[model samples]
Target: MSTTPVSEPMAIDSRSGSAAIIATEPAAQNSNHSCRDADLISKYDVSGPRYTSYPTALQFSETYTEATYRQQAQVNLKQGIAPVSLYVHVPFCQNICYYCACNKIVTADRSVARTYLDYLHKEISLQSELVGKYRPVTQLHLGGGTPTFFDGAELTELMHLLASHYNLSDSEQREYSIEIDPRTVTQDSLALLKGLGFNRLSLGVQDFDEQVQRAINRRQSVAMIKTLTETARLYQFKSVSYDLIYGLPLQTPASLAETLATVIDLSPDRIAFYNYAHLPQRFSSQRAIDRLDLPSAQQKIAMLALIAEQLTAAGYRHIGMDHFVKPQDELARAQQAGKLQRNFQGYSTSLAQDLVGLGVSSISSLHASYAQNERDLDAYYQRLDRGELPISKGVELTVDDQIRRQIIVQLICNLQLSIASIEKQFAIHFSEYFSQELLALQLIENDGLLSCEGDKVIIHERGRPMLRNICMCFDRYLPQGATASFSQTL
Candidate 1:
């Protein structure tokens, strides 16, 4: 599984964010990292973090408290870290999916949502006091148990409350997105979201096969998705993304291929084809699934191959990791321009310096530290009721961590890092500061994952999927035997 760098630069499509159809190199040249190669995938299909954040969320601890969050929030605000990003978590879901791992509450009670919304508004106000009510919010994301679980009026009220406290961006360039359970969202609901300035929608459609859907306890028809897609398009939403999962119970190569085919027909602007990490020991909902019914490692690899082949054939450019998008999409543009970023919300085009997370189990990444809110619903409520921030844990980054973070981000986003730039920025010799890490990377380099060309380390095309493995060598706190806790790297 090795490759030589192409003599010409790999094709990066110039058509907005369109597919980078590399004509100079044979498709098979990158097969070892492609979704179509089973043997290649099986060999490196090991567990690893997604690297959404440097040091990763698993490193968070109780030592970082609410007071710590407040102090950092104040500092970031007073120092003018403007045009920040906000992630609002809605942890309530009407039903549970057997394979879900998110922090969520399952209930059919409307009262629960009402109470939660009230507290969420309160938390927003409290945070505004610390960070100021008028800081420009460049991006606002609603992620959840099912953000659409709220009625139209409730959602409108929530939006109004946020606008009252935060000086949200008025420019069309701002990204206002929300995750929706298509089953619960209606045409009217879609209109409401559009009217409220939510320009992007991420729909959860793990699989369309009836048997597979039943096995995961999430049964939604292809017709439902078609209707939703049509409505979203009719409303002229800026971007519509569909989320699909592989490795669920009863999922086979054939079933997954069919799923991919249907997803391609839907023609979403973006697709997130994720590998389902079945960790029943960690997520209680997973206990409902039959492990014996899950796909074998080889089968999972085959499924991955099929997904890559199908989506690539459908004209979606691989934007790294599980995300693929039309080249003209903003994400593709950012990737092409080397300004793409990864955060708790996954890949984003926003370059905001600070990201504030509100609601239970939400995590905030500030300029100097990472802070997470209380994971327990009762505890979060109690703290907020007492007029206190609900922060539970976080870590403050040191100079070394910051340097490694910048390097990892560069590699992950652009697949290249300039040693001279890093050395000049950090005021240290690159070889001297990361001698040990460079030594470790030699193994991957020998495998053709990357090459150190004097002052730069360029990740070859075949190495794109293994970005996590490459970045892990730089993590200071990656403990032995901890890899098993994370999902398999595809």
Candidate 2:
């Protein structure tokens, strides 16, 4: 949310582009030791913020009004207004995947999607007007309960609508991606997506084991995903990403190994190997999953290690927490060039400083503030029907918030923190400003999880799996025992 620099003193980004932090020679193999440390796993694998945004969305309050959101939208955010990224959250899904924790509506009726698209038109028009209509949209992502829920004609309409409202880029360098459910897309739909200017594909292939699939209520075959992967390449989609999850309802190292073997044969350009967090109380759909069937903590840790070892051996570069990419992928290149940044949508190429999120329950990241649309369907529609922004809650970052945000994002993305660079940028002594937080980190520093010397906080291999716990020390809002709401780090 901290959009701009304070008097140009606070460095804008942690990348080498800014005078903030310099990255160490990052090795994908560094994290192989993380899962091996039983003590390390037991001590630090607790609930905490993922640091996609500092002052995480939990800090968002209703007091932050639509007026404040509008004011910031009109103000050209940090670095003199370059291009912006767009994230459109489609809320409707025909069937529910029990493991999913995203904001979505599950229903058999198809009419709801049509209704949602109509209201999206009004929201898109309003958003384009507030944020500049001419600002080149270099990045566009369609995330959802299921973005592929719409038919070909409906999806074509959505792309056309976005093009009309904003200066959607046709540049080869642009990143236009969508999240797809393997069951929802057809050969024609996949072709239509490529024709519609989406160059990237992120497929949700939670697991390939049919039994595990049935246990989670998502029954897609490895053959189905194989066909889709082949078709994606034939259509010349720039990147194909597969989202795989571990610690599911019915899974073991042997089953996961088979799944990974199938995935490797179908080699996606990028793979996000996620740690499954079963919080049944937080999500009703997950209640269907029997807790007894879930993998043990030790097994989950072994699974994580297996993923890292297997992917790296297969020549995929592990980028940040859960993402693994081919050496030639844009993400790997971005990391090497120090142009990577983490957002609500995992890791990004840092093409734009501001990301505009539209549709119900979507959150937009402006330079100084974060804002969200009405979370409830009725509330969202009623506000839009009255020709108003469907805002609900958000938070504007303070100067202190900005400093900690850079620290967390740097540690998360690059695996190192440059304390001297941060001090120079924010015009404060890092040690003195964060005296208490430093003390909290000392215990872990002694454990050799991280090296917090005079000017650097370098996360070693053992610390990679504990990234959330490391970042949690800097969170002002996340006090002790307040982690009941979050998922485990491992």
The numbered model that scores best in TM-score is 2
Q: How many pairs collide in each candidate, listed in order?
A: 5, 2
Tell me the tens digit of each residue's lDDT in model 1 across 336-394. Answer: 77677766666777757888888888778877788888888999999998988898888
Worst 10 residues of 2 by lDDT: 1-10
Give a tens-digit lDDT track for model 2, residues 35-121: 677877787777765566777767788998888898887675334448988988888888877776777788889998899999999
Candidate 1: list runs displaced more than 4 Å.
1-43
Instruction: For each candidate in the order shown, give its overall lDDT on alpha carbons.
Output: 0.76, 0.79
Clashing pairs in 2: 3-367, 3-368
